[model samples]
Target chain A: MKKIALGLLQVAGLTVFSLLVNTLTSLLHIPLPGSIIGMILLFLLLESGVIRLNWVEVGASWLLAELLLFFIPSAIGVMKYSKLLEADGLQVLAVVLVGTFAVMAGSGVLTGAIYRIKERRSS
Target chain B: MITGLLFLGLTIAVYLLAKRIYASSGKMYTSPLIITPLLIIAFLLMTGSSYESYNAGGKWLSDLLQPATIAFAIPLHKNFKVLKKHAAEIAAGVLSGTVIAVISSMLLAKWLHLSGDLATSLVPRSVTTPIAMSISQSIGGVPSITAVFVILTGVLGTMMGPSVLRLFRIDNEIARGVSLGTAAHGTGTSKAFELSSLTGTISSIAMILTALFSIGLAPALIAVFLH
Candidate 1:
C-alpha cells in the first residue's frame, strides 16, 4: 500500500512539473514543446544529482512503458483522414518503408566503419 | 459523457488484451500498437460512431503523453555513462541517419506529388510518436496522420531491421542498436533489448539523439526546401 501511494505521488509530481513547464513555455514563446523542455530540465536535474533517480524512476518508467497505449487515440484519429489515406496511402507507405531501410543500412554501415577506424587508430 | 467513458473503457480493454497477445507471442506483427488501433477502428466503424466521440475519451489517454514525454529523461539519464563513452560514433551514425531520414522522406513525398501537409507530416515519420506528432503540428502537418506514419515506420523498421543490418554487415552491437533506434525509435529500441541489454541501452540513447536532431532539422529542412 505504501509503495503504491509513493508511486502515485511520484506520478502526480511529474504531472505537476510538466504543467508548470508547459505554462512557462507558452509564456516564453518557446518554439519547442513543453515536454521537450521538461525532459531536458529533468535530465539536467538528474545529472546534477538534484533529482534522485528513485524519486521519479518508478513513475517515469511506468509512463514510458505505457507510452504505446497513450498513442492509441491519435492513431485512431487517422480515421478522420480516410480520404487522404485512400488516395495516397500506398505512396506514403512506400516512402516510409524505403526511407526506413535506407537509414538502417546507411547509419549501420557508417557507424560500424567509423568505430572500426577509430579502434584501428587508437591501437 | 457516459458514452465517452464507455469508449475509453473499450479502448483500454482492447489495448490490454492486445498487449497480452504481443507479450505471449513475442512477434512484431502481433504488437499491441498495431493491433489495438486496428481493432478499435473496426469497432468504431461497425458501431457507426464518429472519430470525435471516440476521441472524447481517447483524448484523456493521449493527454498523458505530455507527462510521458517528460518521463523520457529517466532512461536517458540512466544510461549517461554508456552514452558518453561512445558519443562519437553514436553522433556520427545518428547525424547521418537523421539527415537521410528527413531527406529521403521529403524527396519521395515531393516526387510523388503529395500535398504539402502530407509531405510535412512524413518528414518526421522516423521519430517517436509524441515527438513526431508535435513536430508534425509545428510544421503545419496533421498530427494524427503523422502518428500513423510514425507507427508504420516503426513497424517496418522492426520487421526489416535485422535483415537490413545483416546485408550491410553491421556486426557491432553499437552499430546495430544505432541503426535500429535511428530508424524505428521506441519500437527499434525494444527490438534491440531483445538482442542484449547493452545493445538496448545504445539504441535508446541513439533514439533520443535522433529525436533531438530531427526536432530541429525536420522543420528547418522543410522550410528550406518546401517554402
Candidate 2:
C-alpha cells in the first residue's frame, strides 16, 4: 500500500511538472511542444542530480510500459476522417508504406557501415 | 456522463484483452498496439457510433500522451553509458534518416499528387504521434490525419522492421534500434523492446532525437517542397 501511494505521488509530481512546462511553452511562444521541452528539462534535472532517478522511475516506467494505451484513441480518430481516407486512402497508404521502408532500410544500412568502420579503426 | 464512461470502459476492456491475446500469441501481427485500435475502430463502425462520442472518453486517455512523452527521460538517463559510446553512430543514423524521411515523403506525396495539406501531414509521419500531431498543426496540416499516418507507419515498422534490417544486413543492435526508432517512432520502440532491452533503449533515444530533428527540419523542408 505504501509503495502504491508513493508511485501515485510520483506520477502526480510528473503531471504537475508537465503542466508547468506546457504553460511556459505557450507563454513563451516556443515552437516546440511542452512535452518535448519538459522531457529535456527532466533529463537535465536527473543528470544534474537535482532530481533522483528513484523519484520518477516507478511512475515513469508504468507510463512507458503502457504507452500504447495512450495512443489508441488518437489513432482511432482516423475513423472520423473517413471522407479523406476514402478519397485518398490508396495514395496515402502508398506514401507511408514506401516512406517507412525507405527510412528503416536507409538508417539501418548507414549505421551498420559506420559501426563497422568505427570498430575497425578501434581494433 | 454515462456514455463517456461506457466508451472509456469499453476501450480499456478491449485493450486489456488485446494485450492478453498478444502476450499469449507472441506475434507482431497480434500485437496489442495493432489489435486494440483496430478492434475499437471496428466496434465504433459497427455500432454507428460517432468519433466524437468515442473521443469524448478517448480524449482523456489520449491526453496522457504528453506526460508519457516526458517520461522518456528516465530510460534516456538510465542508458547514458551505451548512448555515449555509440553517440557518433546513433547521431549520424538519426540525422540521415530524418533527411531521407522528409525528402522521400515530400517527393512521394508530390508524385502521387496528394493535396498540400496531405503532403504536409506526411512529412512528420516518421515521428511519434504527439510530436507529429503538433508539427502537423504548426505547419497547417490536419493533425488527426497526421496521427493516422504516424500510427500506420509505426504498425508497418513493427510488422516489417526486422525484415528490413535483415535485408540490409544490419546485425548491429544499435543499427537495428536506430532503424526502427527513426522510421517507426514509438511503435517501433515497442517492437525493439520485444527483441532486447538494449535495442529498446537505443530505439527510445532514436525516437526522441528523431522527433527533435523532425520538428526543427520539417517546417523548412516542407516549405521548400510545397511552396
Best by DockQ: 2
lDDT, candidate 2, at B221: 83
* Structure candidate 1, residue pairs in collision: none
Leading candidate by TM-score:
2
DockQ of 2: 0.76
TM-score of model number 1? 0.88
A17-104 per-residue lDDT for model 2 (tens digits): 9999999999999877788899889999999999999999988887777878887887787777889889999999999999999999
Residue pairs with colliding backbones in model 2 are none
Q: Score chain A of each prediction against the true chain A by TM-score and list the results.
A: 0.89, 0.95
What is the TM-score of each candidate's chain B when compared with the real chain B? 0.81, 0.91
Give one digit per residue, the lDDT tens place, for model 1 in B131-213.
88888888898887888898778877888877897788898988998999999987787678667766776887788789899
**Residue B36 error, candidate 2, Å:** 1.2
Model 2 TM-score on a 0 to 1 scale: 0.93
- Model 1: CA > 4 A from native: A120-123, B129-144, B166-173, B190-201, B219-227
Q: What 10-residue stretch in candidate 1 chain B is worst by lDDT?
A: B189-198
TM-score of each: 0.88, 0.93
